[model samples]
Target: MKAISLLGVGICGGALIAAGCRKTNFVDKMAFKSAINNYYSTRQDCVWPSPVKFPVQADTSNYEQTKGYDALTDTGFLVRKAAEKKRFLIGSKQVNDYDLSDKGRSSWTAEQTQPGYGNFCFGHREVTTIDGFSPADVSDATQYSVSYHYDVAGVPGWASTVEMKTAFPGVAMDMSGQQSAVANVVKSDSGWQVNSVTPTD
Candidate 1:
């Protein structure tokens, strides 16, 4: 409707995939489970930060919440920081925040995101007719885990990259003059606090 320039008010999310297919199997599951268990063995990383405010729907209302941040709120912060430099993604998306639980870990296979775990391959891979920009637009949209890369800072390591489970579907950017993939970086509380979400140009 309006000029969807590189300066709009929206945040974005995406996933990173290893080139080629290296399907994960039984062993990979074991290793991933072991990794999580060992990492959480100290009873850390799984702690849900005290929420500034919680929802009545949440079975437990103790998670950190943001003004527009949704389930993937951890990754939302990075997007927020990136918005300072770009307007195209000023306030594009939101995600629900939850604890990554340092409790007895289970394998990702138990979750079934192999071969394309961090990639935007498995979850909510929808083909719809009209994609609207409201929660109701994708209220019934499928949810899934997608690996996203946030580099609003324009640096590599500074970028926060991780695979996260999210409820919202991907938002398409009407880039009138560019050949950009539906790209974005979401903030999550997997524990890695993101500094920014600079899109790769």
Candidate 2:
């Protein structure tokens, strides 16, 4: 009876040790979502000038482009000047030229790597869902491709204006619903790290 009691106690202790040593799932949708959100939280949504020049010119015929500048002008971020310039195979046409206003220059987010090039930043992005990811052993895989959706957060009143929304499709889509995006995450000592996030059509 003494030997049987000792054997029973040993079996119970072994079972408890096995349960305690169960492997943990470190990589999952929640982990990826957190990593993606962390990546965007430090970034800004910036719209770069298409022409990359001061006094950017836009032909009045292009309603979308002209309206975009008009919206910015209304927001006090741009100054529009009228001009008449010759067009190919046509008479001189009235054009609208734009340059950054004092407020625009103050709010511009200049690119550190490229001098004399900057953008008007509106807001930051936040992850809403982690749609899916590549299947691999969490412990063995060095990288994973994660598909997700996100929305722009903290959008300013100017960006949400009807004119701005109509002019910039990106702003409209970002504000209307979640936008699809893909991110590459790599394993590191600190856990999953998002390397890059790119918007998907």
- Assess the local accuracy of residue 148 in candidate 2 as a C-alpha lDDT between 0 and 100: 86
Candidate 2 residue 122 Cα shift, in angstroms, is 0.9
Lowest lDDT block of 10, candidate 2: 46-55
TM-score, every prediction: 0.13, 0.75
lDDT (tens digit, per residue) of candidate 1 on 94-184 = 3333322222122111214333221111111111111111122232322211222211111122112332322321221111122122212
Candidate 2 — what's its lDDT?
0.81
Give the residue spans of candidate 1 off by over 4 A.
1-27, 45-201
The numbered model that scores best in TM-score is: 2
Q: List the residue pairs that clash in candidate 2.
A: none
What tens-digit string does per-residue lDDT give for candidate 2 at 68-177? 78988999999999999897888898899899999988977777776776777888888887787876445457889999888888887888888887787777887766
Superposition TM-score, candidate 1 onto the true structure = 0.13
